[model samples]
Target: MALLDAQAIHPITLPDGTVYRDTVYLKNVIDHPRMEIGNFSYYTHSGRREDTALILAPYLGHACRERLVIGKFVQIARGSYFITSSANHPMAGFTTYPFRIFKPETFGYKDLPIKDTIVDHDVWIGQNAAIMPGVHIGSGAIVAAASVVTRDVPPYAVVGGNPASIIRMRYSSDVIDELLGLAWWDWPLDRIEANLPALSSGDMTALRRA
Candidate 1:
């Protein structure tokens, strides 16, 4: 089954009895009793969305705009911030109030387009990390705590710092390629569960063959 379809089955019930099936509400505004959160996703009071897969930690924040897209098996630590949009200001000589009155054509807003931030599968965002807008975090990448990601991150690389820099790769390039080829997340949950023993045994060869 597709990830979205699989997620629709499990509904999350909030404190007020509001049910959040997934982030489907993000597609369009809805007035349901519950917040629709996706499968394997997690969020905190700070407005961070760890959806598109599993969220493994607490203390994260509310996702900036429900449009934040996280991929499968993502592990986001506490205090992480994923910002999707930025408030634009008038670049030309004009009034700043009633910002909506001046459209992109009127000012330089046209130059600044809204870009969606995407965190690909198997990503690990450390605690207190801040992901800026338009940044694409490649699959299997790791972002260190308190780091500020300003650019796209390469797959399987470890990055850290205020202006996040590549510290090193989590695994050898060949290993990363092999793991990507494995594509375990695509397996049926039931099948994966059945083979959990083999997977957990650190036998990549077995997993790949499976």
Candidate 2:
């Protein structure tokens, strides 16, 4: 049998074969119009399956202009949530208070700049991490626990702390470029399984050969 099942709502199976219900494949569980989740991207949350989208991105409404795009093989730990562009008030004005929202006719903030939050392939976001509006997390980046990401994270970087900053790059520029070019996440399931040794060991030569 294949190890991964994209259609499974609860993706994680324990060593004893019991399904771990807290972990859900985002693509299968989320059906929000404003959210785009790639295959095998899972989030660990205690919320009901139907509320996965809402729990992941509370501010992203169906009518909202901003999108939350999460790529393949992304692992989001418990308590992590995305704060999208819709959460922002009018910062251009003197008062941040949204006076226009009270009136039903003028509720929309169409003038506010909207930018999609993008989490690229193979990113692992640690527990309690908060991804702020408009941040683009590059492929293979690792976001540390309880971090507040306010800026763009570079490819294969290890970022941590409030207003997350890059602590270190996982690989040298050349290697990162090569791995990005490889894009193993895009491979077919059989091919991916065949390259497990190279993937797990970070064997560039073997990956290239594969």
Candidate 3:
């Protein structure tokens, strides 16, 4: 049998046979209009299952223009959240406080620029990480705990700290390019399962052979 169930809300099963309810497959639980979640992307949160979208991105509203696109096999830890483009206050004016939002008719900053946040496939975001608006996190990247990501993260990069600078690249440029081309995350479940050894062991030769 396959290890993961794409349809299951709670995907993690403990060694003792108990289901770990805190972790949920994001695609199954999230139903936001402006958010796109890929399969097997799981999030660990203690809140109610129905509140997944809100908890993950509190600033993103139903009517917001910017979208949050998360790709397949993303592993987001507890207390991590996204501050989307809609959350930004106007910078052109003298004061940052929004004066026009007081009235119902004048509410919202619809005229502001909207940039969608993209988290690519196989990204692992650590606990309490805050991804700033419009940041494009590349595939196979690892974000360290409590990092404040304000810029784009390169693929296979390990990023950490405030403003989220790249600590190191997981693989060489050539290898990274090859891996990106291979895109193991896009493979069928059976194919992925068959190549588990190479994937987990980081055996590039075996992976290429697969």
At residue 37, what lDDT does model 1 achieve? 26
Residue-wise C-alpha lDDT for candidate 2, range 1-210, written one tens digit per residue: 888987898988899999999999999978888999999999998989999999999999999999999999999999999999999999997999999999999997999999999999999999999999999999999999999999999999999998899999999999999999989999999899888999999888899999
Error of 3 at 165 (Å): 0.3
Better of 2 and 3 by TM-score: 3
Write the candidate numbers in order of decreasing lDDT: 3, 2, 1
**TM-score for candidate 1, residues paired by index:** 0.62
Q: Tens digit of lDDT per residue, candidate 3, span 64-175?
A: 9999999999999999999999999999989999987899999999889999999999999999999999999999999999999999999999999998999999999999
Predicted model with the maximum TM-score: 3
Order of candidates by TM-score, top first? 3, 2, 1
Best by lDDT: 3
lDDT of 1 by residue, 1-210 (tens): 322344342324678988654323221222122123223444332232334222311212233232456666666666676665434344455765546536765532434456667887767788889888678898889999899999999998999998999999977888888878876666777777666777668577777667
- The C-alpha lDDT values of all candidates are 0.61, 0.95, 0.96
**Which residue ranges in model 1 land beyond 4 Å of their true spot?**
1-38, 44-67, 88-111, 197-202
RMSD to true structure for each model, in Å: 8.1, 0.8, 0.6
lDDT of 3 at 113: 94
TM-score of each: 0.62, 0.98, 0.99
